[model samples]
Target chain A: MIRSKIPLRTLAVLASPALLLPVAAADDYRDYRAEAMAMVKRDFQAKGIAGLDRLEQDGVQAVCNRTGNHPPADVVRRLEQDQMASVRFPADGKLMGDWKEGEKLAQNGRGFTWTDKPGLPVGGNCYNCHQISPKEGSYGTVGPSLYLFGKKRGYGEDIQKYVYSKIYNAKAYNLCSEMPRFGYIGALQEQQIRHLVALLLDPESPVNQ
Target chain B: MRARFILAATAGIALAMPVLAQTGASADFQKFRDVMEEDNPAELFEARGEAYWKTPSGPKHASLEQCDLGLGPGVVAGAYVQMPRYFADVDKVMDAESRVVHCMVTLQGLTYEAVTRQPFSNQSGTPAHVNVVTYVAGQSRNMPIAVPQRHPKEREMYQIGKEIFNFRAGPYDFACATCHGTDGKRIRMQDLPNLTRPEGAIKAVQGWPGYRMTGGLMLTSQWRMNDCFRQQRFPEPKYLSDTVTAILTYQAVNAKGQIYRGPGIKR
Candidate 1:
């Protein structure tokens, strides 16, 4: 029934033009990507804080996007290493801060949008994607639940540093994780990341309780 | 023994409180939506739209009876399902909303700025263009989507739309794919549609030009796309631009064979 509805002459016309295109232009997704990027850049007008640079892809983003978030193992390893190297741990070497402050950061989901003010402390936006505190009635499940994070994985110095690093630059561990690079993007400060680490690792925190 | 049983039952309800709170609203919303579907308020907007289509107004004092919606001048049925097509008169492809705006400008002598000044309805009132789109979409009820790929420009738009879907940038490094590329995943309780496939794409295209019960305002797909970019923390795209038309074309073509249940109600 569906076949009967299609105009055969129109299909034939559609086939011819596509056939006449050059082989490189016909099959390359890159050409279309370039054209689409150009269109996006053209059609969107910069307003408030969201500048044209927001549309620009960094090196890591470019690789993940081109490969559909599955870059070659060698490239992933190299990029991951670079991302890991980008993390600047606090000079004082304290990886843990007040969980009370961390809880506030986790609850906040604002910053860096066109509507937000610049130079203000940004939010961790943790609850938007991770089940952080069991007491929180509404939490997202984009990432695995971090309930009992410290209880499950012993509250040690190694684990504390790992949590700090992960929040600072998630791409260091997974190349294309949906979790944002909170600290690396300048969206979170050094103290802010420490508070989040404390939230995950502090035994007294609700996540561990 | 009776006291013990009552205490245990109280404990059970306390333990279940969070789970209940989470699912309770959505379940209640589902019931409300079912009731609304039987007699949607979108009909009021549709009736208003028909009045707009027939009434002679605007600067030229002309009605839109002679407006070509791709079927022909004054032909409205099934045109919504087959639009975002190439119009030879303009020599560019246009979506249903864009085409309606064009007619309002050319036939009714309404300035583009004036017509699109308030493209979306708000707490104040519903826009005429949104009502017109709802009315046009209603004419295509239960029809199979057949957005044409006959034009070279139309096919190019589909390709461009595919690229835009996968393009990642901005502060969070999110594309539409981050939330919507995968199946059986969600943010909070809201289920995300994997628009790369047909089943998922159909979900994206379904029930648009709908009346949202939350604000009691009518909305179109154009407003939805605009909100997505806003949520992604990107700058807004110009109204009736090629960027938005490309994305609409991509979704519509992907959902080609799905039945359109026109002018829906949303919670």
Candidate 2:
């Protein structure tokens, strides 16, 4: 009876002071990010959904990590073009999907954790870093609030394309942007990016409201 | 798919509900933390650990009486804060856990493989190495934090640690900075330590080898690192590996003057 009443995951969230740690490393102001990656490659092994290849930074990550996320203008211009060239748009040329599905994907933060089942579907985790739908009360502040993404940015074809490409490869627009190259790595599929595009660019979407 | 959907819905509402709940929940959590600290259960582990340190129970039938924790032999006090230090015997930098394993092998004649197993804890109480490490950390409470960086290898460890702290990988592309790195950021109600600054770094690293109240367990920095990597979605680091000490060196040097206050309780 107790087992029936209780959830299986009652233990996962228990006493998690690991993240609540208040310590930060001082800016030794050293270029150790590359060496750190080498150490990680040697120190860590692959398990489940997470693998060794994840340690291998793409061109964008290599440049960003090396420069402390602050590259020179010339470097940024060249790299941004390189990143933007990587986005593969849908063959159909349509750039919108169901907003309701988009809302679900944006709200969901489950995916790609080592504990997660391999090859299972992943969530967008958008709310972990951005505000998407206005109704979703809790949103992270790592990025600018996107509650009026469509309204403020102007919901146009170019806007739709911009939103689509940005979500696909954020570094494509701004070199060394903290946002992951979501579309660049296929973390989200073509349709999923389209759905996310709708969530951000559709006037009817709660993000616009 | 259905389970995922249901879980997503549950998570959505859970994240959504807090704005309405406001500050009341936070106050209750704070009160709960205060009560938990009023009497730390980690002391039990410390007691058992103290016994393990003194009592002879190895192939050599020896106690760790002569084991040097960078504070000479058998001097437990203030040794933990200066750990992850370079030891001439092994010719490498080691954190508290690795140093214990080294002592266990040479002083007590235990096998490295057994003492350095994958998971630090078991279904049965705490592992021998973990208990000893936990006890040692308890001895250094209130001592000023001072992990050594004199040796070239020690300095190398610190540099490597800086990178690992910011190393972002895996499917989600999350790194330590994904949650931390900002001045004031939190996941839900939990505070995310900005591990790049002194004030934040001291509070984050000092209070480990802590007791987790919900699970009724004593945790070493090794276990804490293991849990963090798991949460960060990376495979586990081998126990007492160079990677582990490197990370510790980075944290310790940052919190150089902050008084240690751990073997503390966690909510």
Candidate 3:
């Protein structure tokens, strides 16, 4: 194993106090928004699976961007309601899928880079931001740990639906969440989302254990 | 029978060692970086870059020896740290790589398209431009970053860059801020730099044109920013776009006065 880099990095930063000047005030150049957007349009080239359309910020995204992910509470409430309306539940009314498959998807963080092939199954990438299964040592702390989610919340249909919708479009519950609208963005299929829900709420899953 | 059983156990332990090693891989990688720093492979690229700067082979048969890198014509020392500053000649602020590209085009009579055609080095080989940047960066080793905000355009680029850093978009809803806006956080185990801060911002400026050990390819910050947007699931920003310069400016300005160790190796 390599040695700790934090101390070395810290020492380097400590070696230069005179050079660490305060950042320029960000008060001005709010007017650059239009120009910046224009630059984004001009400078960014769509390649492979990532299209120019990806740059198009929807109303929700625009609000989030403009507010620094801190839109006024009222705006957040309304936007979150709108987001909730966009979550399409499976007509079959079944929410949970195989936990084993969901576990695999959580562990798999590969997909959606420009180099990735289209039409392939996308991973849920749950473990990248949340702790779900106790066995996972490398889970990120971006989102809350969902370990024992079903054990704590119960294995009811309502909770299952909540988990399903949350995975599909997280902004429905909380606007400006770092969590992606996985199903809304068409990154995860309804069944894939269902599997994720099971991974969180299935009593037999490692998450509950 | 005992000998056979002992051999099987030893083999099993050997097989399990890699898993144990993976647990401490980050620390191991840091140790590897420490050891490798003394005899970095980046110096080889720096030497080649120096040669490229002096060599004349493009359509005009001119060398980048006469190229002005904001400091003045043909002055390579400490130039990397003072850019993405505004260039009066080009009427735009340029980072080290873009300036190298400009010189390759303007001085050597190469087309922008041709020079940047395979701008980044790949498995096949290191690009001339990437090496050029390495050489330029090497000249600025141990020099302070002074990314200028003296010119109106330079100031404007810094402001625009700040916006881009915080601007959230794409399938992931990630801005550069999402991962890098905070400290003591990691996507997995890899620490994310708080790019908004001085200490954190320097990380972005340091060690590029880096010799990436994984592919053994030399890469510049242009590739770094482009790849960041790609990983953010956003469309690729064109090579040497103002959007990128703006972001680089913001980081550099934040990191102003910090010492750049020049071209270094990466994991």
What candidate 2 gets wrong by more than 4 Å, as runs, is: A1-38, A134-137, B1-31, B122-124, B172-174
Clashing pairs in 3: A1-B28, A2-B27, A2-B28, A2-B29, A3-B27, A3-B31
Q: What is the interface RMSD of candidate 1, in Å?
A: 5.9
Clashing pairs in 2: A23-B200, A23-B201, A23-B204, A24-B194, A24-B195, A24-B196, A24-B201, A25-B195, A25-B196, A168-A183
User: Which runs of model 1 end up more than 4 angstroms from their true locations?
Assistant: A1-30, B1-28
Worst 10 residues of 1 chain B by lDDT: B22-31
lDDT of 3 by residue, A84-198 (tens): 8878999999999999999999998877779888765978778887778988878776678899999999999999989999988898898888888888878889889888888
Chain A vs native chain A, TM-score per candidate: 0.86, 0.80, 0.83
Q: Could you say which candidate leads in lDDT?
A: 1
Model 1 TM-score is 0.86
What lDDT tens digits, residue by residue, belong to model 2 across residues B143-199?
888887788878888888888777665544567766768766655445566777777
Please state what fraction of the native interface contacts candidate 3 reproduces.
Answer: 0.65
**Per-residue lDDT tens digits of candidate 1, residues B1-267?**
555455455555655688555555444544555556668899999999999999999999999999899989999999999988999899988999999999999999999999999989899898898888899999998898899999889999999988888888887888888887877665665667788877888777777888888899999999888888877878788888899999989988988888888888897
User: What are the per-model DockQ values?
Assistant: 0.35, 0.25, 0.33
Two-way DockQ contest, 1 vs 3, winner: 1
